[model samples]
Target: MTNHPHASSDAANALAALAAAPAAELEHILSEVCSSPAWAAAVAAARPWSDRQALLAANRAAMAGLTVADLNDAMAGHARIGKPKAGDATSEREQAGIQGVDTALLDELHEANAAYEAKFGHVFLICATGRTAATMLAALRERFPHDAATEAEIVRGELRKINDIRLGRLLGDTA
Candidate 1:
């Protein structure tokens, strides 16, 4: 993937566009990546990224700085795993594994989602991009036993994975 000749230039162009965008516009764009205003603001303030790597590093740093409240803010933006938010292509695409799942499995997934949320006080989150419905459900159940602090760290890690994928898309880096 690093062998691609135009990758660097493309990333530089994307970074430049982000850097030059108006504050509101940049924040709005970033909100789709991670809903926490503080995260968006931190990344936005560190504009004029030198390269794709720099932007990615900034994203990691900003994510590490997120408070529990900020994590909640980011989590609020995601829909439940099986129930993708209307018009949210990202959620729909990521949760594609749940599509056409058996009725019994769907019902079980719904019930598990409710229970997970009840226990964790947030939606069941996973990097559903390439995972099956059963896989996500199993993860939800597995994580259910974890304490709040542990779960929060897991959520942060998942959120970082999601952020990296989204930012790659934003930069048109399919590879």
Candidate 2:
């Protein structure tokens, strides 16, 4: 990705550039933020955000309105909770807590992930930033009983949290 002049700028300035960027460029940037094409397009079209908070609010709203198909599309971008691969530094860092656990724990996580995928028909999605591998496994197990509709809603919420974190990073807001 070419560093657009505003990519490293402050939140307000970056968002201002995002609003005015060419459609393809804006879509590319927003896709990195969230995988759902509809979500990205909606957010890009609703640009000119007043501040970081407004951008986050729009993200929340866009995510909240996602359909099950959109949610599934977005979830496809995530690695299974404890099994992040070498690619995608953002995912690796978000799931850093799971990086160096015992083999037994990693095996258990793999098994739980398989089970979760079997039950939900999608990878277990969560805001794994700051969460332990055990916690992620527990969450997968806990959510296993939810019906498909319920699980989809939970996934949407998790996706929203992820989008917020990624958006903050995009805008160079450490907090």
Candidate 3:
């Protein structure tokens, strides 16, 4: 990111490059990098990264404080169920991640998602990494009965957890 040998310049440039992106581009990048409320600020403040590890670490740290709204926005960038892209096949993780949802589970999740939206006026959000179809389906069923405020917070937490695992793999960096 930086031309000079100094770590400061590169870190600064990486962060600046991210910050200067147009709002939509920034949002897409943030969603691609990690979906969390703290995404914008963390990516925005990624200056002075010592390396890829530090950049990802800062992202994790910032995501620790993400609000529900942030998680939802990040999810908006994802391909919805029954709408898989060929590129999703490019990432084995995505394959494994998506494979966790079986047809039956997908059907139930769809119904649950619609019900969740009807009840809460938002998407039925989750961080689907490493989750099995039954487990995800159960989770959707379990969470479906919750009231709006409680469910909103739960979805946010799930998004954060999912984001952490995603970034950890993406950059080979852990928080």
On TM-score, the candidate that comes out on top is 1
Candidate numbers sorted by lDDT from highest down:
1, 2, 3
lDDT of 2 by residue, 1-175 (tens): 1355665455566777777889999899999888899899778867778877888888988998888888888998888877786788888999998978988998999998998898888999999989999898888889989999888888889999999989888777553
Q: Which tens-of-lDDT digit does each residue in 15-84 have in candidate 1?
A: 7898899989999999999999998998888887877777888899898999999999999989898898
- Candidate 3 Cα lDDT to native: 0.60
Worst 10 residues of 3 by lDDT: 166-175
* Candidate 1 vs candidate 3, lDDT winner: 1
Cα displacement (angstroms), candidate 2, residue 36, comes to: 0.7
Q: TM-score of the candidate numbered 1? A: 0.93
Q: Report the error of model 3 at residue 150, Å.
A: 1.9
TM-score for each predicted model, relative to the true structure: 0.93, 0.91, 0.62
Can you rank all candidates by TM-score, best first? 1, 2, 3
Candidate 3 TM-score versus the reference: 0.62
Between candidates 2 and 3, the TM-score winner = 2
